[model samples]
Target chain A: MPLFSLKKNNVHQTGSGITPIVFSHGFGCDQNMWRFVAPAFEKDFKTVLFDHVGAGGSDLSAYDSVKYGSLDGYADDVVEMGRELDWREVIFVGHSVSAMIGVLASQRAPGMFSKLVLVGPSPRYIDDEGYFGGFTAQQIEELLEGLADNHMGWSAAMAPAIMGNPDRPELAAELTNSFCRTDPAIARAFARTTFMSDNRADLPNVVADTLILQCADDIIASERVGEYVREHIPGSRIVYLKASGHCPNLSAPDEVVRAIRSFV
Target chain B: MKSSGPSVPLSDGGEPNAPAEDLEDLYENAPCGYFSLSSEGLIVKVNQTFCRWTGFSKDELVGRRLRDLLNVGGRIFYETHFAPLLRMQGFFNEVALDVMTAAGEKLPVLANASERRAQNGDVLFTRVTIFPAAERRRYERELADARAAADARNRDLTERWVAEREQGELREQFIAVLGHDLRNPLAAIDAGVRLVLREQPGERIATVARLIQGSTLRMSGLINNLLDFARGRLGGGMAVQLDVSKPLKPTLQQAIDEIRAVVPERVLQMHLEVDVPVAVDHARIAQLFSNLLGNAITHGDPLEPVNVDVATRAGQLTISVANSGPPISPAAMETLFQPFYRGEGKASQQGLGLGLYIASEIAKAHGGRIDVVSHANETCFTFVMPIV
Candidate 1:
């Protein structure tokens, strides 16, 4: 109700730039994923990081199933946090599902963001005719069932594949730990909302200058999906990273940071 | 043995070449498989034992990621869980996964992996050990089957319990119907006895008629109590049909007269003061008064008169019956209104013990109550019902 709490919301603010850069982590992760990249901008820009309602150290009581059934609900939280911060021309950097959330938020309050940085974002996850969203409906349903039956085992199995750094198991371990710490029911709901959402229509409504960061060999968000996002959003730029996984922030943080710095 | 030229050869084992061959054979035929992967997860080297266990040639395994040898589910686990654990902790042990053989059949296995890092802190290689776990997989499947069986048993038990409860309800309904059906035949017999007594003139025949009439009335009381008890217990509760046209005082008088005929020796003093015509269940109120007066006639001191008073004040109809009698015990008074609770003393030694219970239930069905006060020389029962 107070926009956010320092302890419950786990909100941290740093840096000296007049316009702040807000980083929202995707599903299966927390603000800690930005550990390597966030510090890079601390010297020049005001950087903000907070865990979503049912993730990390944030207040789990803030999570409502009905309210958070869609990405628009999450977008409302971002807009509310912005209003509370009273910042103008802020840069919003969201990864995976949070990218669509930021898009929805900026559309609602057009003046809230000056630029958008969407890393490995997908507007839709299930494939339709003429569009390749990577997964089939049945596959997504299996994923949901898998998450329900063996949430802990699913976390252990999926964290590494999603992280995509089989060489450095530590990165996968970090992702698994992050996934395990999240509330499973909220995670399931968030997963459904994220993967089932079709926000390509909302992209045309976004007025922010967007940067779509595409990983070369991401299994989650393919290059075509990233191109789809870029083409829909007016004047949005697409930058392909040399990193080969879904999470360049953890695998190739230096590249991710340089890309953000150059665009912002 | 102590020859000076070859004393050094005697120090070595007699068959030194046997040890070299044994070491090579052990590497190729160990109980568990062993392999090594580069930092990129590409299988750089695999022992003969590992290739034989996985049904793959060394050529097929080399240059392929370890995950490629696993089934779809196991591949996901290897990439997601096993890889991360090895990277962070430098080793992971006892991970259960399925390996895909060259024949495409799956073999469940337990595996362990440890990371080898270069001097520069970069990953160099990963060493892995694998063991077959067919027995463990079978045990897990058995546990799942047992759980499913237990769930089915619980569901069966729940359904049976519901069916038994429904059967119990049907039995109660049958008892209620049996009690109700006995009433019409009993009334017909009462009317025939009355007709016989009116036509007969001889003193002995008249006495027989009176005996039959008394017995019939007692039987009627027992049957009525049974009907009310069954209705209250089985069919929710006793139902009262209020007749607004009936005069309250005359109804009370009729019940008093009926009780007096049974105990002709006991004198009954009746006082009725009612100016208002009240709405009440005529038959039930008559039954209520009869039960109270009969209880007084049976228990009251034979010498003392049983007094019956009926009055209407404001919106309340009050009926009180009082008689001089031995005081009821405290324990007897506690269970006085419970059905079929026959007492041990004078009041308990008679009747089926459902009279007062039916009376109380009737009063309740009319949204009223009956109260009792018994002390030395006085036992009083009061019935009160709201008319407006």
Candidate 2:
């Protein structure tokens, strides 16, 4: 379970009570990621914001290896936030790993949330039996071992690959500095949880109105994985933004927010 | 010596005190080291040749193990790599290892070791050879340096070849574009003449025929200018000269008038600034003037005037053609005098990109140089030739 709270006054509005929205941040990040989209929707909807365990402004004591072992733990946290807020009808928008957790949590609370918008979520990270995920076991092993070896270096290397895309080439430096400021311990733990976790089996159970905004890119998620997500989720829709890299929120923020706003 | 003799005796088998064969002839004088080690690796015997080879007295090394002579790193390598390879091969040949002598000096040497077994198949001793590698090391360094120098020279030659190839291709591309400058208008003339001959045959047609004749002649002159460029490059050191015995005034006037014919109705003002009759190639001088004149007309702003000037000083004939023009970039100025070089993509001027190229070539052929100084709104092209 994650330790976090949605500061009530911090939740401004841009939308009516049609469906109150919750912004769940991706791995290694906090609710501060919704700075751009939150204001755009704050006046109309009751927006709920929170941080995951082992992340920004969250309770460090609540973090446990067993509960947070699978992404299902994060799913429980998002669902609990909806219940606490009394949001009967909710649109849960997530970025990166939180996007997959959103799918799992929405699957759990089928009647609680009306829609799930997954931004840059990759399921089944490793290639199995007869598939290729670009990353070999050696690479995954190196990622885990290297992160443990030097968390700060790993984050520095990875942040640019995710953010410095051709479409939004400027985001890389911002993300590099932002991720560098993150505490190394929390980032390492989060890195282990993000890259090493496999979320393929959870996709089929997601019945919420799912909208996956996968940036047309090479680094973060490939078109194959995006298609895999769309294929697995029964009625999920995918929109491939003509952009590159993993974190299009910082790169293609307007395009991402627009897809969510219009999709609902 | 010891009292015991060989148990497997000679054919006579008698207890005869036959003089023992000289041990020197038997082993000490051999080129390689010969030694016998006990089963526990204690050296029982070694030859004088081995002692001399290792700079050790026989007494110092005869009872010592072979590993003592090897460097620590060499010992590790021998045990790990050499021993394993030797075990598989039975008789190791030329296994290279480093050795530290009694003086503690490192020597690179190749050794061949073999197990000397008895008839009963029990291990007896190992035989080895150590050859000095100083000469081989010297030879290797010499070879490497030579190879490196040769590789560098080859690389430089390859770069020069590529530059020349690209230059040739640039020339071809320029000529192909110049074919448009020399031929496009000529083709228009050809078509015009054919139409006049077939449809409009009369005195009016004669005027059209005259225009065609004029274009054909201009194209012929452009072709001659191109040929002069080829001559400059291909002729290397040898060149044809215009006899200085011919008067300079007449030659300058001929050049000015010829250029005037090309750019008709354009006001060309000239000054015969030379006091003494300067010696120069008449046609070649005119070729230079024509290039400068054409460049001024093409690149100079249409509203601005073209001025021609001539001056002589200290056995040098200086011809200056000044024009009003926009500033040429440093990059363009750097390459402006290069033969057949058009200034970037915008140099689609009427001349066969060879005008300036041939002009420079002509100046070089006559032991002279052409230089240009241009700034915003003004440009002056000067040709300096040594008085023949």
* Candidate 2 residue B183 C-alpha distance from true site, Å: 12
DockQ of each: 0.04, 0.01
Model 2 residue A9 lDDT score: 14
Cα lDDT of model 2 by residue, B117-231, tens digit: 6665445666666666656645644765686699999999999999998898677557545644666666777676667767766887676575565556556667767655654
* Clash pairs detected, candidate 1: A160-B80, A161-B80, A169-B84, A169-B87, B343-B348
Each prediction's whole-model lDDT (CA):
0.77, 0.65
User: Which number leads on lDDT?
Assistant: 1
Which 10 residues in a row give candidate 2 chain B its minimum summed lDDT? B80-89
Top DockQ model: 1
lDDT value, residue B171 of candidate 2: 75
Give the TM-score of chain A, superposed on the true chain A, for all candidates in the order listed.
0.88, 0.80
- Quality of candidate 1 docking, DockQ: 0.04
List clash counts for every candidate, in order.
5, 11
> True interface contacts reproduced by each model, as a fraction?
0.01, 0.00
